[model samples]
Target: MTVVMVEEIDPSSADAGVPAHFGDPVKEQRLLETAVGLVDRSNRDVLAVPGDERASWLHTLTTQHLSGISADQGSELLVLSPHGHVEQHAFVTDDGTTAWLDTEPGAGAGLLKYLEMMRFFTRVEPRDATSEIAVLSLVGPAAAELLPELAEPRIGAVPGPKFAAGSVPPEATAIYSVRPFEGGLARRVPLGVDLLVPRAAKTSVIEKLGVPRAGLSAYEAIRVAARVPRLGHETDHKTLPAEADFMAAAVHLDKGCYRGQETVARVHHLGRPPRRLVLLHLDGIATDHPPAQGTPVELDGRAVGFVGTGVRHHELGMIALAVLKRNVADDARLTVGESTAAIDV
Candidate 1:
């Protein structure tokens, strides 16, 4: 049987907007936890870097140590400003010739421009590949079983930059699969693979996969519960990698000189980041909508932080991610709008 598609599907997805759910949000969440769940991430932007020097070029641009990233390997990179503030975030995988990058919506243009401006004498060429490719995230207990090679590769899960290409739709030239890291909050969420396929073959591939399609409503709730920080939500131009807890995953402390290396080193060695990410447990007794993003978080009437993404977790009730002052105690009582909340670092 073929997987059914929504009749009036929104291609741009502007009609449904974010947090759009198909079925019961809780049920969809459970689907991701127990079985396979498919999430259409076409709303995300993609950039393709094609050239002989793509890997070395990007290696010097971002914090990840890309020299070790051979074929079928990948890494998450953070583009920082000269002051060591996170300006962009992307997951990168290289196919020897082309470096494929997946970034948050509306962030591709800026990244492309930055890459172009700094292309003094490098042989790399970066182009927007959003129209050429589409992204689908498959997650659940069965995900590894569905894509065995991606989960358990023969060479012992190539450490540096893990990526693989496989057959999907005939029209789709390649299916790039990335394995999620097993650390941090990822340990609490279901392990999965992120598939990047040709734009024209997205529907065919999804239908052939025969999995329930989950929407942002289910994804956002689980993302908050897992304490995973997104680009637009928990990060901005002023956010630093260390402050977002991305130091271990995205930044390299011992790498050669990069644009923001000075600031990163200074912050890491002596100065502490003023703000840090925390999970907020919102008071469920409130009869109104949970605190919106950017809501002020106060400690005993003094503003201490700002709320990021707030969602109703199926099991955890109303919870949110917040960027709070480092001085704030982990058990501090916080007030958001007319509601009360507790902090978890």
Candidate 2:
């Protein structure tokens, strides 16, 4: 078995309390936002589903249009509880014979267990591939140009667009790339492209690509700016897919019955989610540090919602994403830590 190795860096280097950075958080963020940046996403977990019933079985499990996705295409998935609360979020891709599912660190084991419990008589089989497979991410305007240089998939040349995707060409092996942001009409200049590579080849590919390494700070900034909600940060067991703004990317309204279809339908049609995710433009000049996760968000001196991920972008200044009451006005002023911030909805 191939073991994925994670190279650890000093935690108290750049932003002491924040996640470690490669070198300078500002420079790394600038690279990700302007030129190009790469991150070792091997820390994330991957689950492989292989068998004749893989496609059909997964289709009946999550909220996404998987039946129509081609062998080279991929989509994000939201695994909701029976009451529509989020249980898991995964990036899923199929290669005709096998389906690859990726999730946040520490969440894979639980996801595998859930899959097993619900599998019943289905022909699908789920196996943990985290030890054998690793993921790398590329971001910025230069991401597209740098993809073909890595591993040219059988799909041929990548299409022109900041957010474009397709399967790796069949002749290729060991690695593959996917346009994680493109999902039908929700087109936008995505944060980056994701490359799924075998664990044994991760180090070699990183050296071969020769892109600047970005740490968690830069990654968090870009993700928050893009309004991407991560598992523990923006989502948890109490979270509803609608509240996290995952409906567009991970939910398929026209799909057949799944775990939490009724609750999703009810919320989308008649009810309003208790809370909604929003980006906050913090008063960096007045704040000493970025608000930590679960920090209180006070409106008019009353607690409403709590903070999630916070980052200071190279050019964008201090920014954070928070889940606030759905009724909170778009222009409402909220307080975080010792400083005030505004919703950038």
Candidate 3:
């Protein structure tokens, strides 16, 4: 497994398939904002839920409303503990017979097992498809525009999240799916497209696209700017989806019953969440390494929250994403390690 760390990444470039950047991150960020940038998400794990009742059964298990989802439509799904604490989160889409769930690295096993345990009498059999599939992403405001340019699937018309099925030309049809979503990077970038291809064609497909590569640093900067909360990075063992503001993208309020729906709904509609995920622009970040994940965040010398993903942005300077006490003033000057922090409201 490849471990993504601030210290391990080089701002300049790295070996292919590594999370680090290639050449210049500032330019990569620019590409991500204006044109399009290539990102290797093969490290992400893909799980398949195949069966006659996959959609309805899996719908009842995840936070997203999947019972009525049509083929090629994409939605972010969250698996929460009984108390509404987030346990696993994945980017999900279907191809009529099966639902493909792509989640953070090394998290597919637990998610699959949980599905198995819940299948008391259901007709769903979850399979780990990571070995057979690979994920690549094309991001930027012009990402959707490049689909036809690259001779890829024209996944258009249907707004929100969509998955259009396509293939790698010249034969071989092992599930080439394209999912274009907005929340992956941010609103600044119009859309982000994820390509799921046969593992054997991953290399050939990327070369055919012929775009500049963006590393995890650039990806992190834009993600933080967009306030996209990752599971392990943003949430601990007890993180409620509302605390990270995930309900907007990951939860369906009137979709009927699901695990953890009570707490997710109560906090989002009836009551205020005790914590909030906020953007932090820091004064002092290491020249080579951003603050480590789980670094303490304080306000008035009192511990408030912990740091999540941190990076030096192309335009935002030293920035990070943190979840803080809801009561903390938006204008309050907070501290993280030796750096002074201000909330981006």
Candidate 4:
């Protein structure tokens, strides 16, 4: 589906070779919200931590607790700089033996280095699995109901009100049909299922799934609407995950002793984050495109922050996720480049 979608894209509709949408972003988003929509996220990367103690070892290194994570259960984790700035984001799952870490494209190597560097006497062996794995997504009201067709190999889950993606593979879909794919619970995007399919079978699997295809544009629009921050987009090297509202999905304040935990604790217990994530309603009537990401966001003629992902949605028109000084008021009117925007309520 990805190969087919990208081949015939309008020159203005793509970025990094992925189409923003297949000409009708509005329809695509509506499908994602109402029917089933498939998205190509093979651009992501994965690492396999196969060892007898992979879970417990990762427990000490990352923000998510993994000491006794059950098979197919999953959670999101953050690898922060010692200063508590966000460095890496991993969607983690354990299939009883090996723990799989899925992350954004080009991030597996750094995460693998971190994992390997911390392995002193622990029996963990980490390897980049990008050559063998790819990620795709199914989202919408019908997403779970269609799991029966793609249930051969699956991955784990994510946390929720308590800071972990809530559904495990078996429970995410009551199908146990022996499909061997890795997955993580999408914490920010509701009712979404990510499939870590074997690279060798990707084309075939996509061809077999009978759903309308959504481009990266539709996906980004919905993500922005949900206010989920994508790593490397909403975060800079100095970003605190807390500033992007990652605490509800990635951070576990009670799990002490992890790297960067002290800083997280201090900030969580004593001080407010210096920055915060906000949803922006872009001026769609005046401009077809929202300001480019990383565009300076201004308020009262002063640069306050930067924009993240911006997209045109079927229901919401133009919207973007942005990071701003914590002092910015919720009702503040801001500007991204020359485009006017307001903090979404």
Candidate 5:
């Protein structure tokens, strides 16, 4: 059995008590408005795919058009099971012999397992590179401005992976631009600057710029608002590409035979996936107790589906993501535990 390890970085240590939860509503609002914030996403996993055939081998298994993606261009890809269930998702960047696959936290092991299983027929070698890298996301309107200062200002987007080699200040940090998941630019600046610098400098950067540090709480809120799907929450091994809204972005309908292309193409052309991902707003007794994963959602006393992710929004109240039966009406009523939520269509 192959072993894979994940490295998680604490936001507090990275940003001096920035509160990984971002508890204050006032501060949250300020952070959202400024369009400039530092988010410590050290929990996400980074896998390095190396070997002469890395790109070609990965292109054959994933759902993106990787053959067309160059080192200067990066794109997001989905890894699906033979039955069309989403097993993992990744943002890939290839520099010919080496490819970087950045995936959600706790996903690297499974991805590595899958890759290892597939490697017997290919020439690619997959290795866990999470520990060697630290990921810091700078988002909002100011993202573009801040990113270029640390790395070469590449005028491209990071849909898959874009690479630029640059240096950071006097710390000797290795900086590279990655495609942004949000509507801004992002660069992955590898902090080789003595582990202590990342922990100490994070705070100084935020304070000096007067920008709020975003946490998981705010990250979820913003992601849901943007209708961006979460890997383990809004998607899983049970979800098909179409059902998860991955068309054109993460899935390539025209790609050659992949693990689950048959089901993906059939379901997509049929115009009826088994389930639909929708947003919802819970009615009455709004609190932080959002519905758990797989909690039954109901409409007109009939079971439709289950809640995926729920957030207690200060303004929107209780908002959630749900995978409901395709036939459910737009105004469907969903029940989670004892609370009733209304689908926002």
Candidate 6:
């Protein structure tokens, strides 16, 4: 089990009010627009599943079609409860003997626990390998340029399940490619060997490559814009996969049976989803004040649903993603907590 906590980088120290997790928001904003930026996501968890039956075991469990996943390809999988709520979202990459599951920052424990419990009947071995592997996200338009300079197997836009492997400067192995997101581009590099580069070298890498450092706040904004439903934000044990937009990205309709497959198939075939995920544009000055999750979303004196994630956009005003009743009108004027917002559909 490898676990490492990264030192926080103070955003205020930078002129752009960037948070510590993301070095400089100003630079990050620039990188988002023009160049690429590196975000150290080492805090996320990486689970390693190794064994002869790893592929079949995972195939029988998760949502994606794991049988077709080759050694060089990767797929996003959603682990859901029998009730159809998301338990964990993972990026699974196979290297024949081992399958690496990269999960969000706080989801490692739960995923590992579930994997362990399920392993009783299978030959798969699940190990927490987050610390042993570091995740560096290179985002924005110029990310493709930086990948070729790093290692062999040039980065290319391969459809589902394909990734490129390469070597980084100072002897580091990197997996660089654009992962599937709602609407934007994201380049991920998982460091294979620990180089233990000095802080100066890391800074130089960022500067020379023109990769901006991002924080959680910037990530939040980017996620909202991309309409990517995160585990904590748009998903829960009470929420179904159909309501969280996972059906469009992670869920497979014709794949072999897996846990929660019945509910997903039934919902999609019937088109009877209880709720729909919709984006909202708040109708007031942007502020840090956001409606609490599960706060009622009222439309025309009727209860619709509730807010999921809310953010104050620099230009787009206050925008949010909400789970509302399927019957709610797209143009409905809704009240999120005490704030008023229009449904962006």
Please name the candidate that would achieve the greatest TM-score relative to the true structure.
4
Alpha-carbon TM-score of each model against the true structure: 0.83, 0.82, 0.83, 0.85, 0.75, 0.75
What do the candidate models score in CA lDDT, each in turn? 0.70, 0.72, 0.72, 0.73, 0.62, 0.61
Model 2 lDDT per residue over 1-345, tens place: 122122243332222222346557787788888889886667788999988887777778887656655565566787889999999988887766778888988789989998898788988889999887777777787887754433232222321222222332222111233433222111112465777777887778778778888766677788889898988788756899879877766776656699989888777765478899999988977765788888889999999888888878777788889999888898888899887999995
Q: Is candidate 1 or candidate 2 better by TM-score?
A: 1
Tens digit of lDDT per residue, candidate 5, span 1-345?
A: 111111122332212322345446435534654566665666677788988777678778888766545554455788998888898987665554567787887888999998998888677779997776445555555555654533442222222222122311111011244443222224442211101113334445446545456665565665565566768878756888777666545776555689998888678667688898888888747445767666778866778787777766667777788888888877655677678877674
Q: RMSD in angstroms, candidate 2?
A: 8.4
Give the local distance difference test score of model 4.
0.73
As for model 5, its CA RMSD to the true structure in angstroms is: 10.0
lDDT of 2 at 10: 37
Candidate 6 lDDT over residue span 1-345, tens digit each: 121113333222211322334434444555554665555544567888988888778877887656545555455778888866778888766655778787777789999998898887788889988666545466565655654433322222212222122211111011233332222123343311111122334445446545446654555555676677877767656788778877644666656577788887777767668998888887765444656556778987778887777765555667788888988888777887667888774
Runs of candidate 6 exceeding 4 Å displacement: 1-27, 148-210, 286-288
For all the candidates, what are their Cα RMSDs to the real structure? Answer: 8.5, 8.4, 8.5, 5.6, 10.0, 9.4
Clash total of candidate 2: 6
Pick out the ten consecutive residues of candidate 6 with the lowest summed lDDT.
165-174
Per-residue lDDT value at 114 in model 1 = 91
lDDT of 2: 0.72
Best by lDDT: 4
lDDT of 4 at 160: 30
How much is 194 displaced in model 2, in angstroms?
Answer: 0.8
Off by over 4 Å in 2: 1-19, 148-189
Model 6 pairs whose backbones collide = 2-131, 9-20, 11-18, 22-214, 22-215, 37-212, 73-161, 74-161, 150-167, 151-167
The 10 consecutive residues of candidate 5 with the worst lDDT sum are: 189-198
Q: Arrange candidates, best TM-score first.
A: 4, 1, 3, 2, 5, 6
